[model samples]
Target chain A: MFTAPLVVAYPYKRTVGTLLSRFFQSLQEGRLEGTKGSDGRVYFPPAEFDPVTGRQLDEWVTLAETGTVVTWAWQSAPQPDQPLERPFAWALITLDGADVPLLHAVDAGDMARIRTGSRVKVRWADERSGGIRDIACFDLLEGAS
Target chain B: MARRDVAIVATAQRPNEVGSTLTSVELILPVINDVIAKVGIERQKIGFWCHGSCDYMSGQPFSFVAAVDAIGAWPPIVESHVEGDGALALYEAWVKIQTGECDVALVFSNGKTTSGPIDRILNLQADPYMVTPLWPGFDSLAALQARACLDAGVLSEADMAEVAARSYRDALNNPIAYAKENVTAEQLLARPYTTAPLRAHDCGVPVDGANAIILAAGDAARSLAERPAWIRGIDHRIDTQRLGARSMTESSSAAIAAAKAGVGDDRIDIAELHAPYTHQEILLRRAMNLGEGTHVNPSGGALVSNPAMAAGLARFAEAAESVFSGSADRVLAHCTSGPMLQQNLVCVMEGE
Candidate 1:
């Protein structure tokens, strides 16, 4: 006797628009810039408006790519379209010129080696197609030594 | 300036299911019309209209827009929608009423859990940049909080089972509820864990359904309800999305909302709470400051049937039902959002 198979489904798609779309467009062009919020704070991935004071963020500036990982969480299984396809570390990297921690994927697969103070570098995707996914993945800065 | 009052004059809800074989308009029309007909209020008289829903749930955007057509909104009666619960829509309408903007308003919502992997769909709500990439689905996140609470001595696994036992048993009396039963804390604990420290029963079932509530102010409200559940106060607030920044065991926003709404000193006869997770119910109970004497979840609460967008509003609707039935007078209603009780809304209802 033969049995019918059961099927299961889940969505792995996301839509990008508005402020985030503009922010990613800049990232795709190799220009990492931030807008100054009403609080006089330069927030990266420019908010539509200052979340605190509700003022428009119009001023822009480019930021250095180097940063230190503040805290890290290891993804045993990465989600679809994420920069890292296998088990890897996602860190909160505060770029040298930025005031807040920026989220990005670290190419390090072994989480036990990744720590709060571990140093990493961005490996910007060679062919930028105008999206946040353009950054692809970052690698351990072994050559930075 | 005196604080004006508003009450839930009429409420209606559909049964809970994992998936509904209905479109948004098909899902909402009957429930919306049912509430409107119950109160006999003309749709044109309604001042402001707002609803709550999430596109992430159905793998589509602006799903709530079609649900509006059931109201025949071609004339464009004032309206808006939040990516949240219909309870928040109720909160928005109440705020407008306090502003003396409109005399009557309608709030509603509907959600289908079976449209996709409901657990994974909730991941979109997490920190997309970091945490969500890890795929720590809702069950895992709740288990994380459950771990924190248990280790911190806030609640034990046994305590969670006890909550499940009570919620499921109570649901038996509720005809519209999805998961009803014959079970106890001991029996619940014996089941294997879905996530360590969290059993299947510990979480609210993902139910698909629709709900709507009618709100009238002052004289117009009195006409719809013999005992217009006057909304003495309604307030809501949100905290930073960083789950690690705040204690998961407490609902700070809900506490602030309760303080703003003046939850104390009144004889709150009944309380309807919306805590999708059992542990959240514990946190919300503390946040709302509802005394032990107050009856909570008389409609069996979310543990029995959690229909996402409609679930929260259904909570307030349940409380209003108690008021309409003359089973209780002053009532406290609560709605929650985000992981644990990160975001909260509270409303106080009173009879004439």
Candidate 2:
């Protein structure tokens, strides 16, 4: 059967709202931040509104670059456009001082190196941009099992 | 407010295939024709036409518009479209009938899943700012859920394998099933993980296929099929899109929808759950409080041959077929969307 590649593309500029704008700016500056929800919980990457209460949030909380993995899935074969070209674990890490977790890649080098509750810290990208990828990926903390 | 009774009178489906050379119109035409013919009704008699499909799968915008050609849109017809799943379109048709504007309606869906890199394509559905940048594959996300379930002591590798083994065995009886086997859970458990905590067998086998269902109100339904599968109760609920915001081990939205749909009101003879992953079947069963008395996924379910947009509607079709055939007294059909069963729709059906 004859076939041709269909590339679906619609390029447009997206204006990141006030909350995420601050969050992305903080990431580019090599600092972690979270938004305080209506409830006492602090959401990393800052939720514009509380997930449970649906209340708009504006209170920002500075968070540590270090965190612990809540849960993770190991990708043995990395795909294109992923954070890392090598094998890594896609983890949900609850950054210290934040109640909620952020989803990002953990460069653990090997599957055995990562686990639930594994300590990790942000590895800032050398060329910083005001985006989520500014963190590049998390690195497993040395001697912190 | 009083609600009008709606029943699924007829359904037609294409067997799941690894890949198909057929265009969306060609794929949907026969099933639409078959369903209309099965009900012994003229195409014009179908008062409303609602379709469910995804443009991401087709790699084009407004792809569903081209599919209406299969319905022969010459005389002009009342039609609608949903970007999600055909079951959601079926929901709209049900609402249309409830409004007394149309008595008979047709719902169809087609997915050319094999045309593109589906795993990579699905990443587009994630939160564009937060999650989409990483380009996480669908299987990787599912594996993450599986790992959470495993860590929380809610599921085990053995349990996941058992669901897969049972589904494969059940698929042998389904002629349209693309993947079927008689392997035991033990043999499956011995296999290596495709993604940690998830074996290849634990995931649904993706296929290219299409399906259609016809809906009619009260008297119209009675006149069409011998025993109409009455939709006694139906409800759809969604959880927070933030994957980390909610518990990955449980589906509270499914439970709420199941209760609202009265899933536990009467004993369920059979349940066709749209769980793409083996562990998700276990999770949904728990959420809905389905007991051992219910025969689950006798048609092999999405695990055997998942055709994306159509699989969910096929669950409705399969459950209705069981009721129509008199093999089951009361049945349940379920459909889920989003990452990790984030959005769920539960439908309960019964026959007199």
Candidate 3:
């Protein structure tokens, strides 16, 4: 069998659109923002249009850095380019004040530490960029109520 | 209501295999030839040609364009392509016939899912900014869904194991299935988890394969086959792209599609669901309200031989084969796209 190095890359950049552009920009500033849908449900990773109504949404709501894990799966082996180099839990976290949850990695240190309904807080990356990676991952909160 | 009745006249598929060295054209040509020969239709007589495939899976831009060589477009013929699964291409052909633009159409799809890191490659299908950046593979995402189902009390681990066990048992009769063995649910539960709450058996057996299906209008269909699987109703629906925003335990789009496709209108003898994960099959069973009487995944379904772009259409072919063989009068076939069953297509077929 023949083998060679092949790289699939997109060198060019594209705009993130109105709502998402703002969401990422806010992330870089070490804050969280969500867009309120017509149904009054706040969606994290703010969508440009209300998912149900299909209408444009501009109402922005500032969200807390802490959230509760709705559900999660333990990732025993981390894949390349993942949020964490070590083992972590892939979780759907509902940020405080937001009706909907967002998917991200949770650095629970061990499987026993993370569970459904466990509280987690964002752990900001030292280096800031206008992207989801700006927050390295979520961390388990100590003595979480 | 359909403007004109459309039926699947002929279908052919390459046996699912892992890491086949054949090129796209090589994989597609045989099936294309086989289906056409089965229908005994002249190549030029086919009013339209539709193809379904993915450039990402092929690792080349315009890869589907190269597959047209199998059809030999010398005189130039009416054709189309979908960047998704072959079942969607069949839907397009069905619509083409309904539009009075064509009486007969050819639909085909091929993919070598095992050529690359399938789990990592599938991560691209997720939301680019939010989920893709994290590089969460398909298995992990599916495991998350499985976990949610477990937490919600929708299904237990024993139930998931039973689905995998049944698929393995059913696949033994299917010559084309990649994975087949007479295993039990208890035995499956003994294996270690590949992704927690989801054993290796829970995931689809990815393979390199192709499938072709022929569609013809009322009279054309009657003449082509002794018994044609008439399309009673077909509908596709999509849920929100935001994965976490939707309920992971249930497939709302699947329910919507099943309703729109009139799945509950009559008793279904069989159901071929394209659920790659064992949990998803359980979820789809609930979504479509498939009763105990319905024989599910008799052809082993996606869990046995999942050829990415072709698996969905394979469900259609399998369901139709049941009708063609006089085994069932009415059947339901379901296909899913996007992560966690975000988009779903349901088709109900009956023999006349």
Best TM-score among the predictions, by candidate number? 2
Better of 1 and 3 by lDDT: 3
Q: How much is B191 displaced in model 3, in angstroms?
A: 1.0
Error of 2 at B25 (Å): 0.3
Report the error of model 2 at residue B337, Å: 0.5
lDDT string for model 2 (B1-352, tens) is: 6999999999999999987989999999999999999999988888999999999899778889999889978688999999988999999899999999999999999988888888888888889999988898888899989999999999999999999999999999999999999999999998998888788999999999999999999999999999999999999999998878988899999999999999999899999999999999999999999999999999999999999889999999999999999999999999998889988999999998
Taking all chains together, each candidate's TM-score versus the true structure is 0.75, 0.99, 0.98
Q: What are the per-residue Cα lDDT tens digits for candidate 3 across B2-48?
A: 36989988899999998787899999999999999999988988999
Output the lDDT of residue B291, model 3: 96
iRMS of candidate 2, Å: 0.9
lDDT tens digits, residue span A50-126, model 2: 99889999998999889999999989899999999999999999999999898999999999989999999999999
Which candidate comes out best when scored by lDDT? 2
Better of 1 and 3 by TM-score: 3
The list of candidate 2 runs beyond 4 A from truth reads: none
RMSD of 2: 0.8
CAPRI grade, predicted model 3: medium
Rank order by DockQ, top first? 2, 3, 1
